[model samples]
Target: MTKTRALRLSGVALLIVGASMVVGPPASADIPFNVAVERDLGLSPRQAEARFAQQDHASAIESRLRDTLGAAFGGAHFDPSTGKLVVGVTDPAMTAVVRAAGAEATEARYSQRELDGIKSMLDETDAPAGVTGWYVDVYRNRVVVEVNRAAATRETSAYLDRLRALGPAVRVAEVTSSPRALYNVRGGDAWTTLAWRCSVGFSATGSGGSRHFVTAGHCTQGAGPAYGYNDEQMGSLGGSTFSLFGDYGKVDVTSAAWTLAGTVNRYGGGDIAVKGSTEAPIGASVCRSGSTTGWHCGTIKAKNRTVIYINGGAVGGLTQTDACAEPGDSGGSFITGTGQAQGMTSGGSGDCTDGGETYFQPVNEALTAYGLRIVTS
Candidate 1:
């Protein structure tokens, strides 16, 4: 078993997506939307609203680029500080098209297809104990490989050598904190069993047309007859998947008294409306809702991230954030200001008080994986 030691990362600082951002106290009352934005990101209400709009604008451009560039499209991330989108492309002809679309175009050394293939190759190899996680950093235009102290021992030298031989498109850095899914904590769409407690990611209906709510696969894996904190039988887990590629689960909501909504709990603040399941761009401001943290905001650091969680095993296709989350925040809500469904909490290294980096299972990936449609308003 991998040592479940807490992560102590000094490798890469949390990429500051939106400048002038800081954490603050949760809203005691139903603060104005702008006020809520101010609390989370420290932007004036106007700036907050404008930034949200910019994210939407950026997404549209990204969509267009994806359609036009296809394989040449490396990836896209939004710049919170300047309210612009940064797009990567392998071909120079695409650069002018991207700039014309109001994005800052950069020539990328490798295509998105190349990176995906490289990442897939590494995924095939068994990761040694020293390897913490590795993911494609579209912003940096390279894959980031994370290692822990265990790799320093002579025993793991050969494994490290093999990892380095994978390619020159990646950089390995020693770090701490093996991530584990935050579980057995109390709070948020709270569900409980004799063993564990976790949050509801979002509500959905699977291909079978059964009423269900999604959550972390780690929470539902190896478990059945799951019940809510309210003590009502919520039906056993179904279609639960974990470890590699993605971590998500579906719970068939069977209780008559309980009702599913497309809304998310906002702690003391009011509920957030789920407008759609559009994925937020990298560097775009995003906030999460969990029983532990209530609500907190941060910029999306990277997308299509692959994390080898100590608890859930290994999973790819995740979104990374600097937003703080503690135990029980797993499988919670991550939504944008415009109420776009982003993802659900996956294991991360830090707590809300001191601060930490967190990852989420992209909602769209989950929806597509299970052929589940997000319950949207």
Candidate 2:
């Protein structure tokens, strides 16, 4: 979404009193003023306002569920667009308990049978020809396989054959793909601070050049006169806003300190080597990293989602994944089985300890928005 620039300033005036004779002229009170002024903080006031609005909506729903469902409700999450509450219940008995309490409840069950079927199909097949990994999206009720190099002649034929064998129950989709690579942050790399804990790429509109990275926009101002990782001068923010739609901030590249490498750390006791830059399908499994949460994995839930932010702004076209994240993880990278960079961390409801749904901004969109490219092996 496009954001416009705005500034917020708060001023306070104080009065002083002293014991003075009526004859003495009253002394003028010293006016004390403190301004918490944020300049070019990155997000436009409209975007910030949107985020606040979303937060209010979510909070109101959550509060109502807690008050009504009470102890019976395991938890509740609201979808802003429909304003529907996905209330979680601990057991079948709790279903009745929830309705009795005056809130709507639905059966929130993950199908082990369907999961096993998908896993079996993946294990048995040769994965067509170029396919990397297969994902079973429970939320979407579909299966997506990641393919390589746009699905060659034989690859496409083999993929169809495999799908036939997997059965019609498993509707299959193919995503032409590549692998993701990893790079270490150099001392001088430029990025947007998603949070004190996470940051991402940015471009500086100056002669110094620009670097690409990921970070949370809320961590810094929407319009930034940003600094490098080493505190060296870098660039300013190009776009920034936070929302349930997936909060992220972008910086215009000012210097070229970022160098792409050829690896993506899976954090599951292995790594995926980079080959090309291909996107994973909707149901594909993906992993991510951030300053707060080192690494975590989950399946893609949906794509092109428009999430509303707590602050009253909305972000369109976000990737929703089951991967969990925290406050500090905003703007971290999300990679797929073949190592392709899928998106960057935005925000989510849960933590690493308990697990929750997370959202991300597709990397390709960022590249296009800032006129940059993802360097691959």
Candidate 3:
């Protein structure tokens, strides 16, 4: 293709990823993760627990594969049904290396390095209109791009044509309604000050050692003095960022009555333990707790994605999921298995009623970006 044509198609890979977890409330235990799995996936409590245990083991093997394969590594994910680690390798020779680590190996067409470079080219393009989002899907070994329509216009068609020149690594998907950043602070929540209501994501300490609770940046934007759910005034909004680089913010909690806990409220059920923020692999089961949806489980669809919201400009480097969320659920907690903090709810297409796709700002990325540590037991 000509240079001009290549430039037209050079938007981000924009792929949709697939992974699964659960929505729960089980009867109660040291961890309620199994309960969610059982509830959402139709698995028995014992089976759900076993699946998580398997995922943990898969995660360990994945770590080994990462160190062993290095640049040969394409990507890693869990087999949702079997809970076995699936490692993608650019070289067929590396299959033995991954299988030696107790993971299923699959040869991939594109190397992770090449994929990353292509993604960088896509990012360099001006935001093409009507394009909602995109990400890299390792399972498909392609960058999946989501468009509002297949044939929106001649320009978009030309753009996609150029994108195809980059190789078979880019695929376009047509989607409904655009992604939006949900900002709603309301009553009867973790910490809602104004009429708008946003849920708390995770409580942490800033680099300077001040206690604060993290949430969606869009939530804290224009937020007056924040108040606890009990209607007591807490500290004001501190460091916050909106849909630009990422979507995350922190609210200083200086009140004596409102001590931050290492647990996420499940709304109608048990509190989720906050073990750590180590992100789970793709296709692992993940659960989100929002005031609106209560608790919903799904799989990690994709990572390092960019979702263009209606009002929140363009927030990049997000994790996509089929999990459901609504307006008041903004900034709620997304956790994997028993207790790993995944991300804060950004936005999605539909609601819990009919099911929808949502995106999150990965907790680890947010923590690293703000130099904050999640308060954990």
Candidate 4:
């Protein structure tokens, strides 16, 4: 594996840094709704609350629409502008049905199945190094393939042409920077593996009632005993996955000193209660907690995205978000406004300063893969 990026330790530069040293105080406490929602989303507290309610309602009915519409169900997203959920349907016959169910329906060129097929094809084929990632943009009703123009070579150009030949359903766009795994030290509440650090995703329970915590697979891959930021031994790295399958891992919490909590560190915002693992729909408001950046909020841009990190291999079934994260923030928690567990930080293109998109391994998939259930409040 490539050497992970190191933390710059700006404001906390004076703090002692080492495996046994306390890099910074652990973030714990409770606060109201995240203030970053106002900063990042440009919404007032009341407006943000309204959006959350609308998103929750949409999530509730999303399953019904999927089962009822079947092949006609293109996808669904919350429209902040109208404060309503919009459902995409390939069959015009389903439009009225969607409206009757209290959602606005729009015609889509393809169904979710077709889009998934295209993405699956891309997943099965080897992507060029210049290609950063790709996902189905439900709003656009097309599959978006992102490429790093600056890194493009003759081979990559030929590859793009071949992808175009796949049909109009494919939309290729240029990205300025490629994503890299945000691995190293520091995060929401820093947890160390050997000398390096990463944030904890969520606490979970194993089959035999064993305590565990989830994090980025890259963070736990080939790692030894796990420890907290204060160097308190927590557990042992159990199972990890970092290839095209996904980017998630489980750490068996073997120490009695560490008590598993179902809350995510919101830095100064306090600890956000994790009530459930309900997947948020695209366009719903979401926030991230990391030791590096604290709390930052953004909206879900897409789902089931596949991102290929510069050094780390392609990881599929990730959810794309506009939230920002920095080095040492890998495995941090991502939660919805309603306190729903989303995923853990995988990697991204930009930082909290200029702002950029981040991808996460959905917590539900990770829990299912490990035969674990999230420790909820």
Candidate 5:
């Protein structure tokens, strides 16, 4: 079996085991219906109950999109994995907006049979330089590209074309922009896993001119001496843990000086100013910027989720969304539709090409846990 498939299969296996243990039988008493949703989706009971409480208008939106952009787009599916609607479109421009909407849209190219064979081959070989990983998402009908940190926009576009050149059955649909700051950082730079790498921002602390940024606990190890973007004199891991893991540790401010900005760069030629770290409502829209997958938007799927991490144990009270992220994308930022700081990237199982669910540590919790303040303009 190919390595990608193997990884995915292994992840699924782990999920099953974890799920069996985490999701206990429902209580005999009148348990809330939302509790069942949380249990089934591998979410902590709290998250499921919260999502169940909110009114979901996603169905109406999906219906409207179908009527408004019929034929221009193909079939649509809501990825429970990402909590965003995956719209199939034939136009690249339309698909681009889908990305902006915080949903993922892909242009259909090859038939599933041909794409499957290509995916098998791609999965077997070590990914090319500037390519982090790839995934075959049957739900979205595309091969998702997880680009390397050093990958340039032109290079990413070239690689997409290369995939198309392989055969008439293969075609390039859409490409998500890379995060500018993350692209600026060198490869192997140490960073915390913020909301599974959804968005990242820099910070500073200590009376001795220590420079660092607060990220999600799910981003780095609780016991760590973290490194800088260039493998330089970054800060020590200081404190790290999955909040849900019942380990609340402050993100250490490294000695390395990082640029503190008043804006959240979306990396899609647009940006949202960092006003304050205010939490958005459950159904409110949100966006994220990260090193791996650039800026992507989606609605708040659920909040206060407790996720078990493979590396740093488990963290609770994460905000779930339909946004996409990759390995290096962890510890990034999640901002509300109005540009309020919501959370940090944690992690998930899919890629930006087809879409995936991402969890984030709420910013308020991060601030309260760390006694840090958000710098604003």
Candidate 6:
């Protein structure tokens, strides 16, 4: 496969093709990709390649299954244990159908629609700060509401009761820290405003042929002019949203000196070519690049998670991952080993040293929201 070629300019370069710790073989240009997955995820390059193909096959057929099963469609996830796709269905009759489609089928208590409805109700109601976030766990076939154990109080308990009353579809999980937006007043590769810094996500183009780069909304929201780590003005915020709508922003690359290449900086490891923006399923391996943490690999834990930050700002429709991130890592690139674009780092509690859950705003959502096309190799 053809890979993105690096573009060097004025001692600054748009890097292309870096390795990641995920289950997938990189293109021919990314030999380090296999080695990275082997070292971090503990899989041989061959094994990782096979698993990536498997997940891609599963993702490809999922839409057809959803249409065929209709309301009986509970949810679908990649089963790492079996190295196959396991689709949940509320109807027993759908089991054979799923199997016929080459996926394992399991019984589910609630359909995806039912569980989403429950989560939607929670999103509409204001929750105590003790509530960190919530998401539909496809494997469990339940909507999980995560709470900060120490932050919980009588008021939080009452709120939990109301959530539980929504029925058995709701499950509570206790976490130690609350989620927050990851803007440091900082790194995929270090872009900055006057007072804060964040990483560049993906490069893209507007419908009118304008060059731009995408990042976390919190990084660009009222943050003013964006600049490269070199302190050169790159552009201005074109669009941004950090509320229930989602956490995403676009920066028009107004500076001719800067290039909008479809690549992510892998720090000293080189770069990773962003080939596409196909969302991976939960349980799939993924890796992210940031200026603060460099590159860290992890598995996707959940999808469509709604995180309520400690500052009272809430961003819905986020994908949760086991990847570790920190302040200033916001807006970094999250990609699969195959070089597929995943998302931009939003925030989460914990550090790279201790390991913690991190959330990302899906790249596809950001692309769609802005009617922009991702620049790909």
TM-score between candidate 1 and the true structure: 0.86
TM-score of 3: 0.86
Stretches of candidate 3 off by over 4 Å are: 1-36, 185-189, 193-195
User: Distance (Å) between predicted and true CA of 287, model 2?
Assistant: 0.4
RMSD of each: 8.1, 21.8, 10.4, 4.9, 19.7, 8.1
TM-score of each: 0.86, 0.44, 0.86, 0.91, 0.45, 0.89
What are the lDDT figures for the candidates, one per model? 0.74, 0.46, 0.73, 0.82, 0.49, 0.79
* Candidate 6: tens digits of C-alpha lDDT, residues 224-343: 677776667888878888988789998888988987787876655577788898878888888888767677778888988999987537889899998888777888999987888999
Model 3, 1-377: lDDT tens digits are 33442242232111111101111222222335455566666677677677767777887887778788888988888897767999889889999878778889998888777776776667667666777777888888889878887326767778877877877889888887787776552211455544355678898888787888888887777645776655577778876787547888878787776777888876555676788887778888778877555677888878888787866677877889888777667888988666778889888878777888989888887788778899775
lDDT string, candidate 5, 1-377, tens digits: 33453354345444221111111111211323233223224456465434322213333445565565655645445554465566667666676666655556767643344445565565444333344334344344555545534444566666766776776544333323222111112111234221111124534243454444666453444354444433333555556655443222344554536555556555433455666765554454566666554566666655444443434433445666777665555666676434467766766646666666777667666656555666555
Better of 3 and 5 by lDDT: 3
Report the candidate with higher lDDT, 5 versus 6: 6
Tell me the number of clashing residue pairs for each predicted model: 8, 57, 27, 4, 41, 12
lDDT per residue (tens digit) for residues 199-265 in model 2 = 4422212223345444454444444465443444455656654543244556554555544344443
Worst 10 residues of 4 by lDDT: 11-20
What range of 10 consecutive residues in model 3 has the weakest lDDT sum?
12-21
Return the TM-score for candidate 5, rounded to 2 decimals: 0.45
Global local distance difference test of model 3: 0.73
